[model samples]
Target: MSWRRALKDTARSGIAVEKKRLEPLIAVRGAAGLAIVIALSLWLFGPAAAASSAFGAFQAAIATFQRSWRPRPELAIASGTSLAVSTFLGYLTISKEPLFLALLVVWTFAAGMSWAAGPTIGLIASSNVAIMLVTVTLPTSVAQAAGHAAMMIVGGLVQAALIVLFPVRRWGAHRDALADALAAEADYARRLRHDPVASFDPQPLMEARNAAAVTPRQARRRPAELHGARGIAERIRPVLASLADPAMGVPAEGPARDRVRELLASAAALLDAAAHAIRHGEPVKVPPAALATFRTPDTGSILAGAPYRAMTRLNTLLQDVVETAGGAPQDGAPSGARGTARSAETDDRSTSGRAPTHPGARGTARPAPTTRSRPTFLALIPKALKAMRSELRRGSPVTRHATRVSAVAATGYILGTWLPLGHGYWAPLTSVMVMRPDFSQTYSRAVARLAGTVIGVAVATGAVQAASPGTLLSGALAVASAALMYLLMRTGQFATQACIAAYVVFLLGMGGEEWTQTVPERVLLTLMGGFLAMLAYAVYPAWETPRLRTRLADWLAAQGTYAAAVFGSYADPSASNAPDVRQALLTARTARAAWHAAVARATAEPVRHRGLSRTAADDAEDALAQLGRVAMLLEAHLPERGATPVPPAARFADALRESTHQGAKAIRERRVPTWDAVREALDAWETENPENADKVVRNTATLVLDTLTELSEALDTAVPPMTLDGTAPEKPDGPRNPKDSATR
Candidate 1:
């Protein structure tokens, strides 16, 4: 079969295999969801009935909300409102005024429902106050009020857990898609560097140059324009000269040409994949075979070569162009304008019978070019306005998620209020704020809540014991609570502040009870509430482990492809292209991000994903960092107009690419390459190119093969083999950093 046909068939087969592998994971997730529902139902009716019922109801509400809401301003308001209403209901139950309590309950419930349906914090707060007034009239004892509060706490906890376990699918999906795009981009960059001639048609280069020349001055101000300009210049440099003359048909004469071409193609494909992933939100797949094709050469000799020196000169030229344009006078300037005036005089003299000024004429008085001014605040206003207008015109996906989160919070609030789950009424309120799918935020909130509860309980116990229950004492406590709440709120630690404030209110509302006698009970109740909140936060967990792992794999794959392209480009220097350079940079950036995230997540949840936990994430991060440095070198050496003293970055890129591919291949095949053999190949290449003077262009096929193979092998060994069900093994017990394990 033709190589092209074989390649196409392999790609198709690989995709199919990957899809099949993923099916079981989807099934496992579904089953987990069902199991949670059943467990929660059973817990609600089991021996710890009071706590269970309240917690269960809250959990159910949160679950429903997660299924519906998208995080946004509207949802934030809705969730806040739901919390206020629940707080009011707890107050009503404690007061024991049946008629007033019933009315307030109805009001709070209705308000919560309304807020959930359409988010508004003001409405929710107003409803909460109305319920609180009714609570003041109830004839209940302090003990009874505390019991109801306990139930509320339990309910909120359950809800929080469920939300954690089952995160919204859309967010995860989008993240995965972004990873795919990055991988494809890296591949593209590598290919272009390896085989510039075949990878980029001359027409596009010409068109790009024309566009650059004709681009509106204002358009150049865009950030992307700068990147595009640089990329185009680098990619087309080699081809530019050839296109001008057409006599530079320097074909590869050896076996290396075919290999080089293949490497270039692979790099291009990877970059294309990355672009697709970023644009469309797809998954990234790195092929194992690509890694087995190349070997890296030593870069020291290449760096000392004449071609490398020439490339450096080109970079200086490009810089000069930028400076020249920046220094130029604006169009339509007055004849006497500072910089232009001198140029105008020169032109006038040249047009007349006088001697024209030499291009290098200096020491003569010439008007300094008008300095480009920095943008002012007023100048930025139009851009800001444009952005705002764009946002207003476009629909946002986040809004939907926000709404769902609010609805869940509201549901939890109402259920906790109505169920009367003993002295932990505030637990549901805690859950509303703490139960986020993003584990990082949730964990932070939970810790804050626990700390605040401890402090609040201590204060309440001391104050209650010291003061006799009466109007004056209660009023004083209330004032103190409000003051503390206000102060803490400014710190932006909402959950902690709320917990402290609530405790003060609980103490004041106890109606003259002796604090010394009730200290133990109060502490226990507070602890219970905190415990419930934590549980709810963890129950419905969305495992970040798989996502992190997958991202690492994709990044490694991209690096391998990039390396191969770099090698090929060095072997035959005429193949540089703009798209390839851009892809390399983009892929490197993505890989860096992925590595960081994985490391963080693993540290946060070390015990959950087998022994591969945070350590594995760290290792991957180190590897990516090394790869990133190499990519930067490749970027630096890309051909550009008028460049001289080019760095040996292209040769380095080629060698690195080969090494990486071989490492990856070894990992995938479960056969480690002899370190000496790999080293020897690299040494030989480096020796031949010491100053890498050849100027012969490398292509994709030659660069990628060995590096890809090595990379595949390394990654396979580092990460566990995909199970039949396509899931990693459960994490083993070990000391782990909570921060690293948590995912946001």
Candidate 2:
């Protein structure tokens, strides 16, 4: 081979190798960002310079442990006991023989508990053990070391007690908040059917749905509440099912159950109708008959008897708003209100020779859509289930991304400990906690770490100055400083507060070393740690944006297909196959969740892939919003019930299928094709009338095209062309991913 060719090959090979090397290092760097700051603080101040640093670490560990402990009391007792045992064991191992073996045992125990019970317990127990061992070897006198250990035990006990007693009252409050939020969501959904002005943003609605669905499960621990709600839903579910059935109509035996079910069905229908109206930007008309049903005393009685009274009230309010919007004014106008004046004018006109006339009243007044002739309860259940499933699936991407992050953190922690960097033990710990793939978190951690180190230095300097050089007073101050550091660590705003307290105690304990002598060294070490963390995070960063975009495209396609099926059924009553309709609805909901996940991933990692930044993500999200609007519009145009209508199912399916396919193709290519071409293609597909087999193929093709277009736009903006190779590249002299294929 020619030397020129060989050189080219060599350069190409080298680049590939470098890329591979950088991948893992990037992950490590991202993870290590905070650890570097902590390490720098320790190195600059020296272990002895910040005796309180140890105490701060201990407190931070305990706080983490407490958070992980499910159901407060068990966590407190477990964390406290573990802390005491680990500290005592660490002290014994350091002061006596078999130091290495003893350390191993403590390490193993901490690791096991951390993995099994949760991070909070493991961190506290491990830090205590590590600190106890380190203090034994420090230049401090045995008596001084003993005093420091005693304070840690006391602080741990106090923290544990506090955690157990109060147990962060927010959990229950959050549950209630979630419930209220869900209630609001249901009301909003109901309003959308009738009120054209009501905002049709699905995000808040989706959030509330997810919250309600999940909260109920979480609150299930409160068996009484859970059972009560479940019982009501269960009882109402069967009755509603019976009423929704075409053959059975309404059940005659259970009057109350039948009535409640009818109301719920009516409410659901109203919500569906509102959603349709909002999507189409058209006014919703509430029939006079529907208003009459609500005006009855029985309506209030039925609503009051329901498990979710708030939901019922919200439904009623939404109906009233819709009625008003439709130009049909209801009773009980506010005193001296304009509506009352209008009513008086109408009455006066009726009494005189002329007839009452209003510009708003154009269309003929019709009775509200009746529940009497609606489909049976069983029919609606499948549709509801489908919607619920779709909503749940939307968060899958976030869950996956979080899982990956946590796994990386756990691995980094284990590796850092195994490496056993002397006097640099905190480096790995800091990195794991601080480095996040998400830029916002990464930036926050880095800032906090830097601030903490600076404060720690200042505090250490002051303590050293006040205590005097090499005095007993210095040692006492060190113990007091440790306690103070412990307190600061609990606040959890920034790393600097705890660092300040820790560094001050360390200096005092170290016999009041001159502040001028050690400040620079501490700062330098901190910088080094930060650099290392950055390297680890950047080298082989795992970008989740691309995957998220792809998932969303698939979801959108599914929703489009479902919309087509619903529309198709509307066109042909003979195609009264409810199962297909139900499945389509479910598919649409799942698509909604996928879209949400994609948005969330983009939001979290705003700078993941070059063009796939926050801006791109937002654009993709906007497109999804449009798609949802389209789906709702199609549903609204469909006939309520009758013979086959215009826009057959086959045509709708073809358009949606092409749209989805196009979206997926776009993502894979990382290029957003002009959606106009795809949209035209769908329109053409719908225009062509074909046989059943041909129609299915055409429909599938349409969905594929649409998906491809959406996917392309989303991915093109999120994932950079260079990073599309699905591999992390290495950089010179950088920590890299061990798992890189090129390395192998």
Most lDDT-accurate candidate: 2
Against the unseen true structure, what C-alpha lDDT does each candidate score? 0.38, 0.41
How many residue pairs clash (N, CA or C atoms closer than 3 angstroms) in each of the candidate models, in the order given? 160, 111
- lDDT score of residue 518 within candidate 1: 38
Give the per-residue lDDT of model 2 (tens digit) for 589-706.
6677656655653444434444455666666666655554444433322333344344444555555556566655655455443344445645565565544433333443444444
Question: How much RMSD separates candidate 2 from the native structure?
Answer: 18.8
| Candidate 1: tens digits of C-alpha lDDT, residues 595-626 | 55555644444235542445544554555544
Q: What are the per-model C-alpha RMSD values against the true structure?
A: 22.1, 18.8
